[model samples]
Structures are given as C-alpha cells and as structure tokens.
Target: MSLVVTATGTEVGKTVVSALLLARYRQASYWKPVASGACEGSDSETVQRLAPEGTRILEEGYSFDPPVSPHLAARWAGESIEVERLVPKGRESGLVIEGIGGVMVPLRDDGVLFLDLLVQWGQPCLLVASSQLGTLNHTLLSLAALRAQRVPVAGVVLNGPPNRDNREAIERFGEVEVIAELPVLDPLNRSTVTQAASGFDTAGQLAGLLDQSQGECR
Candidate 1:
C-alpha cells in the first residue's frame, strides 16, 4: 500500500514530509515516481538519507537531468513520461509516494496532470503546505482542487514558521486536519527529522487507509 504526499506548490517540503513519515512508520518505504533533477539531486536520495536505516527505495518511473517541470524536462530528454506508468503496482511494504510539484503540474504535453495521476492511483493524500504569509489561500485552494478531483486527502502538514492564525483559518475554511507544524530546521538531518516528527500525527491518520487498500489485495 502507498500513501501519496503532495504539496500546495513547488518547494512546499513534500520530500521532508515523506522523510518524516518514513522515519515514523517502521514498515514504510519511499518512492518518487518521476524525478526532474537527477543531475543535481533526486528526492529519492534525500529520502534514503533521511529515512530510518535500511529503508527500501523504489526506483523512479522516469528521471530527467534538468531541474524543470516534468513536461519540459521530459521533452529535454527527448521523451515523454507516460501517465499510466507513473502509478506503480501495490507493494507489501507501506510506501510514502512523493508527488511532483503541485496538484495541477502537467506530467506531459497531452495534459495529464499530477492531480489526474493521484486520481488514477486512488490513494489518500497528505498535503504539504507552507506556513508563511499567503498560505491560507494556497492551502485552501489546494484542498479545493483535491476535492474537485475526488482524491481523499488524509490531512495537511504545515512546513514553515508556526502561525496559529493561518493554521486555524485553513482548518476552519478548508475543513481538513493539519497533522503537523514543522518548524524550519537550521540544519535538516536525521536528528532534526526525528525531533520534528514527534509533531506529526499523520501515520495514525493514514493507518486505516493503507490497511484497507492492502486488505483488498489479500
């Protein structure tokens, strides 16, 4: 079973949230299906470094050398990212599947969006959001997009300075849980992830979803 981790937008700490889940969930593995910055660094590399020791990393569906949008990066590589291959088969180990960019990021020129990919996977998602100014709008809009696509969002994780007012506004208007408020760590390392993960309550929220998804296979 896999639990998808998406963001309100790019650089919203989606990978960090996935690392936190991998650290907290003993049975969890990590996978980022499509990577654009393979030359610079891959999210899978960060997860392997931050996840608990000996964690399993599933290879990506596709990788491009440039740090760009999947559509552009794939084009630069003289290929296209097939929408169907992005959804991996269900696995025995629990998985934290990291999504690319935001919900509406185009996976290819033909107009397959990440939100569409989420719908195809039919997996409950954890939205990673920023806590800086203007987050309320982005977070709320993100929730709306997910709802419009009929993707079950498990909750949200605010990954920036702690702002009670904004957090409350999101919860009040969006009607979704904020599972954790991760402070900006000076140095992001395993210790920081472990200490910060105590603030997260997403594993329990996702437990039932993963159990049911895996149970259907059995």
Candidate 2:
C-alpha cells in the first residue's frame, strides 16, 4: 500500500511525521514529488538523512531553493512543476510520498493541483495537521476537500505541541481517526524522531492503517 503524506500547509510537521512513520515501519520507500526552497543545507536534505534504513529515495522532478510555493518557485527557475512527471515506484514495500506544499498549491499554470497526483496514484492519504491553534479548521477543510474529490484518506496524525482539547475536538468534529499524537520536540533534532520511532505502537494503532500483505505486489 502507498501512503501520501500531506499537511494543511508547509512546515506543519509533515516531514517529521513522515520520518516517524517510516521509522515505525522499519523499512519502506520514500518520495518527495516536488520539493521547494531547498538550499545547500535545508530541511529536504535533513529529511533524506533521517530516512530509516532500506528507504530508497525516489527521484523528484522539481527541487527549488526559493522556499516558496512550487508554482512561483518553478516560475522563477523558468520551469514548471508537474506531478504527472513523477515516476511511481509501484507500491514497493509501501511507498510514502510527501507533497511539496499545501493542498491547493498549483503545480503548473494549467491549474493542476498537487492533490490530483495523489488521487491519480490512488494512495490513501495520511493527513498531518499541526496541533497549534486554528488547526481544527485547517484539518476539517482538508478533510472536506479530500472527501469531495473522492480521494481515499487513511487517517489523520496530529503533530507538534499536544493540545488535548484541540485533539479531542478534531476526532469528534472531523470524524477521522487520530492515528498518533506527536508532541513538540526540544531542539527539534533527528534524535527526537528516532525516539518517536522507537515508541510508536506500529503493530497496534498503525497496523490497520498499513497494508500488511501486499504479497505478490511486493
């Protein structure tokens, strides 16, 4: 089974949660379709570094240093970000694809949305929403959009500071399962990711979310 990891917006802990999920599985393939604002030393590089063992890094079509939306970033680079160009690794050991920006971000001027690719690939999405204030709206809106488009949503994972009230509201109001709650990490270092990985009850909470026996496909 392939899982698409996306957030309400950029830097909402999508990569961090992705890393943690990867670690929970111990082994999987990762893909970042359209990365933007990646300088010489950037979070994308850090993500690549934090990937668990045996995680094959899939090729990305667009990597921009502008740290902005892919459309504008690609425009600056005299190109365009098109999700159709991304080569699918074909459900090998469960692919985890991370989107470049938020849901509505345009990949090309032709009005192609990033979510379209996730739908085309037919991977159940794992929504990663920040635990900060105003997350309820973001989370709900994202859920509504996905539902409207007939996209398969696996579940939601709340990241960053743990707000018990907000978390409870999301589960009740959004009507989606909360797969995990990742607290804010001090220094926000890679070790925190490792610690989270070690503690995840993968075989329990997340097991049902994962495709256990893609036997012949794998």
Candidate 3:
C-alpha cells in the first residue's frame, strides 16, 4: 500500500516526516509531484540525500524559485504543473508522496486542488499536523476534505509538541486515531532530524498502523 504525507500548511515538517516514513519500508518510492524554491542545496536536496539506500524515486518536478503557493509559483515560472503528468509510474512499488503546499492549494486554472492528486494516487494518507494551538481546526478540516474526496486516511501523525486535549478531541470526536506525535525543534534545524533518522522510531509507528489497516482490509 502507498502512503502520502500532507500538512494543513507549508513548513509543518512534511519532509522530515516523509524521510522518517521512507526509512520504515524497503523499496518504497518517494515522490514529490511539484516543488518550489529550489536552491543549490536545500530541503528537497536534503530529502534526496537522506532517503535510504535502494529507495526508488518515482517522480519529482521542482517548479521555480518562489517560496510561495504552487499556483503562484507555477504562474511565475510561466508554466503550470499539469495534473496529467503527475501520477505515479512504474511497477507496484509502495509510495510515500509529499505534497508541495497545503491540502486546498490550487494546481491549475481549472481548480484542481492538491487533494485531487492524492485521490488520483489512491493511497491511505498519514496527515502531518501541527500540535500547537489551532491544530484542531486544521486537522479536522483536512480530514473533512479527505473524506469528501473519498480518500482512505490511515491516521494522523501530529508533527510538533504533543497536546493532550488536542489529541483526545481529535481521537474521540474526530474518530480518527492519532498514530504518532513528533515534537518540533528549532526552525530549519537538521540536528533533531538527523537523530530521528539515525534512530528511526517512526518506522515502527507507521508499520504498526499499516499492519492494523491491512488486517482490517482482510
């Protein structure tokens, strides 16, 4: 089964979560459909660097140098990211796709949202949400959108400091399990990420969820 990691907004540690998830499985392909703000050496480069050995790169297209929303970035680059060209390819490799922006960000003039691409890929999603205040709305809204699109969500992985009330409410009320909670570190800092990569505990958490979901499917 494939898994896509997404957030309510940008800068919510999606790449970090993607790397951790990639470390979990063998031969998992990592694909970022559209990326913006490509420096010579940046987070996208870091993602390629930190991916485990034998990992297959399915598809990646970096648009341009604007650190803005994908729609604006694509427009700035004078070319749009076509949805037709963005689907997964090759054999039945398990995937971990990371989105460029938030869930509702537009990809084309015809109103193709990012979530549309996720639905096309047809994978159980692992939402990476912030654990700070206001996360409840962000998490629930994202879940609502996913449900509206009929996407099967595996569970949510809160990607910042853990909040007891937030987690409980999302579980009890939202009815979606909180699979894992990862703490936030210094902004753009790779130290905690390096440690997490070396330790690789998120793999167990993700694997546990995948096993549970698969059994349910059977």
**Model 3 scores what on Cα lDDT?**
0.71
Report the C-alpha displacement of residue 200, candidate 3, in angstroms.
6.9
**What ranking emerges by lDDT with the best candidate at the front?**
1, 2, 3
| Among all candidates shown, the one with the greatest TM-score | 1
Ranking by TM-score: 1, 2, 3
Each candidate structure's count of clashing pairs: 0, 1, 0
lDDT of 2 by residue, 1-218 (tens): 67788888887988887777676665566778788878745544666667565556776667888878787888899997656678666656667778766777788777888878767877788889998898999999998888888888878888877789888898999888877888887756556777777665443555434554421211
Candidate 3 Cα outliers beyond 4 Å, as residue runs: 40-43, 90-92, 185-218
Each prediction's TM-score versus the true structure: 0.92, 0.88, 0.82
Report the Cα lDDT for candidate 1. Answer: 0.83
Better of 2 and 3 by TM-score: 2
Can you give the lDDT of residue 145 in candidate 1?
94
The CA lDDT at 37 in model 2 is 74
C-alpha RMSD values across all candidates: 3.6, 3.4, 4.4
- Cα displacement (Å) at residue 177, model 2: 0.6
Q: lDDT tens digits, residues 52-86, model 3?
A: 65556654765567777777888877888788788
Question: What local lDDT does model 3 show for residue 154?
Answer: 81
Question: Comparing candidate 1 with candidate 2, which one achieves the higher TM-score?
Answer: 1
| Worst ten in a row by lDDT for model 1 | 209-218
